[model samples]
Target: MMEVKSKGQQVSRREEILDKAARLFKQKGYVATTMREIAEQVGMEAASMYNHIRGKEELLEEICARVAETYVNQMNEIESSDLSPIHKLQALIRSHISITTKNIHWISVANNEWRHLPDSSLKSFKKARDTYEDRLAEIIRSGIDCQEVADVHVSITLYTILSSLRWIETWYKPNKSYNARDLEENIVNILMNGLKKSG
Candidate 1:
């Protein structure tokens, strides 16, 4: 029982360290953040941090990998669903917003600091990102074929939507008046209106 409790506390401490590292990485770029700073934020001795995590790169890899996995899994589910092309796009938008708002710090770090990941982790992150984008593009292509979306360039449409969504972390705040649901609805309405085929 004592051993289990010790293990649980270690896991909890590791999570706290990761959370602090993510916040610092979001505020200060990953390249700018140091392992000692992360330890200080988590109220741990600098030398003791290694008991919980390997190093700063490990923190970054975990953050990026978790966020990438979330997006890829959500995209897979959205793509496989029986929803219409337009509806699939809407669901995709909602899922993106939901994940972003819920994991704001992690998402921010993952988006802006992932380029600093070690080479192998960098490659894995890019592959997952590409898979997500390709699946989204396929949905857009389906929409165009069904005449539910305008005949715009698929790459342009995909990038436009993704770029817009990606920028939300820059201005969005949980304590702000503009809540996630409102943001989601407004974004969905705006982007959908632009993509929908007109008479």
Candidate 2:
């Protein structure tokens, strides 16, 4: 029992460290953040920090991988759903807003700092990102074929929607006049209006 409790505590502490590291990485780019700074933020000494995490690169790789996996999984589910192309796009937008709002720091770090990942991890991350975009583009293409979406360029449409969603991390604040749900609905309405085929 005591051994199990110790292991649980260690896991909790490691997660706490990762959270702090993510916020720091968001505030001060991954290249600018130091392990000692992360240690201080988590109220641990630099040496003790090493006991839980190997180094800054490890923390970064974990954070980036976790967020990327989440997006890829969500995309897979949305792509496989029986919803129409328009609805699939709406669902995808909602998923992005939901993930960004709930894990702002992690999302920000992943978006802004992923380029700093080591060679192999960087390659993997890019592949996942490209695959995600390709899947999204396919949805738009299907929508166009069905005449559910306007005949816009798939890459342009994909990036336009993505760029708007990605900017949420810059200005989004909780407890503001607008909430996540409200933001999601408004964005969906606006983007959908633009994409929906007109007479």
Candidate 3:
């Protein structure tokens, strides 16, 4: 008979591996963080990791997928709400920026480490990521039509908004002074007002 572990134990082990790998990736980067090193961090043999995942690349994909999937689902939920286009746009952007800060490493993994994956993995990852971006772009397009967001190139505006927030991962640190909500407010203000305050 097969041995059975409780679901909580399985989930905890998975989270342990994911969390340790993420920290290693963030600290040592993708190229430098070897599977052996990651395994050792969690007191397992490097080969034993294959029991949980195919390879290091898949782990990176999983980390990125978690954030991307969360954003896509959040976008879908926001879109279904009864709010006006302006409110929807504002609320979604706020939530999106907050999420970026919450899972800041996703930005680095998405932009930096994802390219090192195999072609098949890359394709799957790109599809999920692009679909998420397209949803955001669709919302931006809606905002433009409704005059909630300014009249600008839809792709450019969306990219600009997202790129600015994604760049935060490089320098952002969770602290008492500023936080995800503060970043969201700043982004909304920049979208609404120019650098020069009106008299």
Instruction: Give the number of the best model, judged by TM-score.
Output: 2
Which tens-of-lDDT digit does each residue in 84-103 have in candidate 3? Answer: 66677677777766666766
Stretch of 10 with least lDDT, candidate 1: 1-10
Model 2 per-residue lDDT tens digits across residues 96-147: 8888988888889989998899999999999999999999999999999999
Q: In candidate 2, which residue ranges exceed 4 Å CA deviation?
A: 1-11
Residue 116 in candidate 1, Cα distance off native in Å: 0.8
Pairs with backbone N, CA or C atoms under 3 Å apart (clashes), candidate 2: none
Q: Lowest-lDDT window of 10 residues in candidate 2? A: 1-10
Model 1 alpha-carbon miss at residue 18, Å: 0.9
Q: Looking at candidate 3, what is the lDDT of residue 173?
A: 83
In terms of lDDT, the best-performing candidate is: 2
Question: Weakest 10 consecutive residues, lDDT, candidate 3?
Answer: 1-10
User: Global lDDT of each model?
Assistant: 0.87, 0.88, 0.71
lDDT of 3: 0.71
